[model samples]
Target: MDFFTAQDNARRKTGRLVVLLVLAVLALIVVTTLAIAVAFYLMGDQSTAQADLSAQGMLSALSIELVFGVAIGVLAVVVLGGLFKRSQLGRGGRAVAEALGGREINLNTRDADERRILNVVEEMAIASGTPVPSVYVLEEESINAFAAGYQTNDAVIGITRGTIRNLNRDELQGVVAHEFSHILHGDMRLNMRLISILHGILIIGFLGGMLLRSMRFRRVGGGGKRDNSGAIILALGAALMVIGYAGTFFGNLIKSAVSRQREYLADASAVQFTRNPEGIGNALVKIGSHTLGSHLQATQAAEFSHLFFGQGVRQGFSQIMATHPPVKERIKRVMPDWDGRFEATWPKQPDETDAPDSLDSDERSAAGHRFGSGAEPGTQAAVLTAASAQTAIGSMGQPDQRHLAQARATLGALPEQIRTAAHEPYAARALMHALLLSEDKATRKHQLEVLQQAAQPDVYQALMDYGPDVLKLDVALRLPLIELALPALRSLSMPQAQHFRICMERLIEADGQVSLFEWTLYQLLLNNLSEQGSGPSSLKLNDLQRECQMLLTVLAAAGQDDPDEISAALNAAESELPFSLTAIEDISDMRALSLAVERLRRLKPLHKPALLLAMARCIEHSGRILPAEAELFRAMSDILDCPMPPLLSEEA
Candidate 1:
């Protein structure tokens, strides 16, 4: 499913979860009321207790003062439990990862494993056409990983040390692909919501534990005033403990039911992404044979079990409460021709490096290729033909092994120094400035003056130094170049990031106009800032029609040359769209247009696909799409959570 459908499924699951939670709360209320009624009846006079035990008497007891008090307590516990958990997670996925003891990997790391994973993630990011995500390494001896974030750009990928130490390069690539699929399919957002809600549900148990502690501390033996009160307190604490533990059981059941189907989908996505079933299938096989078996040793593992690359913790309720499918079943799904037996894999030696290993004759004969070599080789030319452009547009949700190889090739094709600079935080900042430099001498001169006054001296120098080579870069490569800087840019301190943002704004405004490329770069950069949190959004599609009109107006105007061509494109795009009649005939004011696109970014996940489809129709009005126009659409799609893979010109 596309992001919209996946998001809608998540929405529906939220509703189902609410229904289940309601049933659980009702069950808790009934249990609490019964416990309270029995406590009062048994502790009261014998004659009165016998009378109260009758059926009608029991019904009457439920409406008594004590039952009402018990019912209120249950309501309070469930409400407070949910509210507290939501509050803890209000900061979003980064908070969730940190809570699980994930240490964010440095952008410039010396460790080979760390550097290898970073390179894999970067290539995946460029291939998938989104900003590189912040990566975290959990210091646990478990073969598992997870992706988390509020949206695509802010997403972070986390892996355990065990995975890095044990798996070969291809196995690591397969695991990372699985996580990237989660990022692309809107699963991360859904999973974050699941974590928050499950935590809320589990808090009832935590409160019960606190109450049990109070009971343990109290002295209830003496026939003193305090002793009598202690007896009642003990009963209440015992009741909460039972109910709270029950809530946790119910929450896991819900998590298991919702997460299992998605795991199968992600497994398929990984194979589809790498075009090598053996990579992921072998990884799973390794997990089965290795002692770890995707089992996490971290204290926080059990709580985030559903988010792992495999089952992090074994479940007691068999398949009913298992968050993932069994290992052999999952492996078989990916590699239909797999041998039923799993061979044990010895962990790599501590001294051994992760350099590419020699493949066996059979493995080598199966596919004689490398990561970005699936495609034959597209000419390193500037033009976009109709066949290639259309294929690229339609390849949004489906990226094959060829796409993976092409992605690696695309990065290789970029200038070596630029690619190297993209990896470092400081040079990355300069890379951004260099990308914004204009080809026109006067415009370039004017931008330099503004950069000198507003930008940091080192940043200005880096831009000036890289200017000529940057100018020679392909239009298709520029976005990916900007994307390459995301991880480093994310490493900026909040204050530093704010300063950077201000400087970029000054540079854009200094040009006295906003070009489409510049506006796209700024908006994309903003989205890539994890602090922004996808900005505030409205759910109603109709409310944002003016913003939609503004977006289409700009796209329509810039995409075509003649007035008739612009009008025809707009009309074609509008034919099915029930948008506002108030459309901009002249889309010249760059700042105003930038604001319009910003507003459009707030369109709900479901609302975005229609807008994108409409815009695509508008762009294709000439019966051909330029490479620049395709890039613009792809960028727009990426921001909206619809990932479009790079169009293959030849192959790789």
Candidate 2:
């Protein structure tokens, strides 16, 4: 999907979520307010009868109590909003995940069949321009897998032992692709948000439980002779507690409804990415027939049941609240007229005999043979080219088994070290440096030291050699490398470490231009990095003037130039700063330049003028401004606080 389309979808969803939250808060207030009002009315009647209090005095107290309750409810929602933004609930869930010691997984420990699962995940991640998420193995023999994290960088993919042993490479790839889709499309963040909101709703219930326990302790300690006031306070606490619990239940229902739809979308996206139905279809069938049946043993699994690949909880009510669709329905969507059964029999113990050969002999034989067969070598080459393209879609393509076999054989040509480095950034860096090194040992050692000192030895080495590798690669090979590097590149602190990011950007543009993938990566990296710190140096009037002059020189050399376009671009960029562009021109000194740049750097992503300057640079890079540049310049002008110059006016 296009970036803007994806962004718009997220914005629309966010708007809906806001509305839902507001409605939920309003409902909560109404329910709690009514409960408190009832309690106040009852207490007022009792006070009037017991103490001969005036009706007016009792009514005034009840009115004050209602106002106080409403104020408290509003305060609670405001506090919850703050907590959601801070992601307190997600942090708590992660703590629970960590406490379960789920991070440790022996990826290298393999039964002959299980080893291929790792290989498939690596291949897909390399193809998709996403990091290979950390994979965990659940010892249970249930057929299931799950993706968890607040975002792509932190995401983890976990699978039951049964999935690895039973599924082939293609099936495993289908499942992983499905999980990766969730990571890519912003579902993980929403999932985390739901968890935090639910936690806030449940806090009142927990407090009520605490108060109830305290009251019981006091009554027991006092031999059941409690103060009448204490009894009244206890009743009030009990009522609040029950009402608070109702809020929690309502919140969970909403969370589950939203989660179920996201799960369906993720499933469809998985199919789209892999173009394989039977792979996921068979997986569902296996889960249905298996004895364990996709149930998780972890207690926290119930809380995050909706986030899993299948139902993690076994409760009947949980099935109604399930985040995922029924397995039968899921399988039907993927495979029409398919008999729902697990073809492979489950073993009482882990079986070694059923493992398939890692390398098929016939596939290897075909790999060693010539590229062409019969009917003219050129025609054979063309057919092979078409088959290779279709392999990207996996089993859904028209390619026969032989084509799949041929594609599998190509995997052997890649270095073992490169494959091993797929999920490990540190190891990936060492491998990259080794690949970059030439025959000169001394020069290589010096370069390695420089990389090591930079604290990104792997990425630095990879960047140094990527230019040469890009030239050597065909379209197929180049695509995988770009995908593989995305996760690794994300690990770096681009905003805080400006020099490192500059080096990366320079390398990506080394061939004198950036591709669509490179541009996407740049933007993604910038967005991620900007969250951590003050971003890259911002564009100021002096900086823009200098860049504009550089563009003018480049355009002039090409013999077709527009000074008006150049002036307009500079004016538009400078107008984005908080301070006036004209004011900076009046100062025209180092201090002014420094202050302007600093202010620009501090601007929010929407307001930043540097992006405008960058767009202008991109437009003028070909030695002339495109018509599109004017629209970008104008959009940026509207976001800036500063006024535009008359020389760069649209009429001009």
Highest-scoring model, lDDT: 1
lDDT per residue (tens digit) for residues 386-496 in model 2 = 222112222221222333233343344333345445334444333333333333456545544555565454565554544243333222232234334334443445452
lDDT of 1: 0.74
Clashing residue pairs found in predicted model 2: 129-483, 429-458
Error of 2 at 244 (Å): 3.9
lDDT of 2 at 84: 57
Tens digits of per-residue lDDT, candidate 1, 50-158, equal 5666766655545567767867887777777667766776656566678789998876677888878887888787777767888899887668889887777668899
Q: Each model's number of backbone clashes?
A: 5, 2
Q: Give the Cα error of residue 314 in candidate 1, in Å.
A: 2.8
Off by over 4 Å in 1: 36-61, 64-76, 223-226, 356-383, 530-546, 571-583, 602-607, 650-652
Score every model by TM-score: 0.88, 0.63
Pairs that clash in candidate 1: 372-405, 375-651, 375-652, 376-651, 378-650
- Candidate 1 — number of clashing residue pairs? 5
